[model samples]
Target: MKTDVTPATVRDWFSEQPAGKLFTMPTISAIFGVAPGDERRRLAEAVRCGYLCGFLERTETASGRAYRVSGKGMRRPTLEEGDRARRKAEARLARDDRKRRARGAPVSPNKSSRVRAARVSLRAANMPVPATAVQHSVCETVEQFLARGGRVQRLTAHWEQMEQAA
Candidate 1:
């Protein structure tokens, strides 16, 4: 079986597989090309995590066991779940990319301008930015200040207090 799972492959398997039950490993592996070892386990985990479901009778085969998606609670995924999942995944990827960039690793160019600015500010200082700026990300503010040739300066307690009074 192949190691990669594609939409076309999954579609083909679902068509041949009885509706309403979950698919078994060998059947899935045959369609998607999952390896017999860790790959198979990983694919199974995807099913267990509710990404896939089974409903057909469990059957033993020479390779391993498998099940069908039982139609009882089966329904197509809703747009809300799909959208929310996509958003969450995108957020997670963005966060990971930020962490990577912070560590001097390469990242994609599609990152938002605000996110980029915040990254710059965070790298330059350890201070906690105000919540309003944090929600927008600190990157833009840092970039704006830097673009104006302004530099961050540490303030002594007295100076900070005096500035606040003024």
Candidate 2:
């Protein structure tokens, strides 16, 4: 738990907790070795990313909320790690955009999914890429799309196309 403190590890830890164990914010934070405030955010992120369940274990507290692990096994990356990965990807995207601009090529803020798929395509095609290239993230692209007032109605093929476009 001390070393592999990733989302996956945390989910495992949550499962190892007693079946009906309820955690106060500070107690949970203590388990994670982070501040209660930070743990609150991390817990929310973990739940949002599907690593944990939506419902609280105890909802009748007057001071604050209490939580327990669902142990449902829907784990994903932790938000802090995701943020770091996102910043790294955006940096790479900005660098690529700069290069495109320097070459007098068309450059706009990129759609993250397309960029990711394009990178995958490049790898599959065995094309030579600049050594400085970095991986792109779908979340970054979606953020730009949202900033431009784009909306997703449903997750049909058309919506998927639009998501890639975004």
Candidate 3:
């Protein structure tokens, strides 16, 4: 009898396997009656979900990448649990986005113009101008630093003090 191949079924199979018994992708595909080509793609997604949901543990072996059942019991994660995980991940990402924006460059109409002028002046002085992406990154960093009431001072004296101590 042909068994239905699904993420839950795959998870169950992994859970049934003895702990630490490694099974590679091809071995799994064959055991689950998963065909090559398009069917393999679906199986791969199922395996990925199993890994993500903590139903399986992946590791590298001498043969290749392999997976085994997680020591965490056979209890399947519910739909609500999956949704909660998704929400938590989204909230973390949003928090990170806010932090990045808080530390990012101030939005100003003349910001690009100022960056362009700086690059032009550097080139005119025969100094190697940084690439456009790097120039923007440096400009943002400097703007953020200055906006925070920070000042740039030559660190030569500090370095000389450290050198004398050494």
Q: Looking at model 1, which ten-residue stretch has the lowest summed lDDT?
A: 48-57
Instruction: Give the number of the best model, judged by lDDT.
Output: 3
lDDT measured at residue 49 in model 3 versus the true structure, 0 to 100: 83
Instruction: Give the poorly placed runs of model 3, Cα more than 4 Å off.
Output: 73-76, 80-166
lDDT of 3: 0.79
Q: Which ten residues in a row are the worst by lDDT in model 3?
A: 133-142
lDDT of 2: 0.63
lDDT per residue (tens digit) for residues 1-166 in model 1: 4645533344445556656554566666666677688777766655543334332345565656656544443345424768979998999998999899999986777658668888988887987767664365545677798889999886679978999899
Residue-level lDDT of model 2, residues 1-166, one tens digit each, is: 2333345555566667788677766565667776446555765565334423433244436657766766454434335878989998999999998898899987684588578878999898997656986787656577687899999666569878998899
Per-model lDDT: 0.62, 0.63, 0.79
TM-score of 3: 0.44
Q: Which candidate, 2 or 3, has the higher TM-score? A: 3
Candidate 1 global CA lDDT score: 0.62
RMSD of each: 21.1, 30.5, 24.3
TM-scores of the candidates are 0.31, 0.37, 0.44
If ranked by lDDT, best first, what sequence of candidates would result? 3, 2, 1
Superposed model 2: Cα runs more than 4 Å off: 1-4, 36-44, 47-60, 75-166
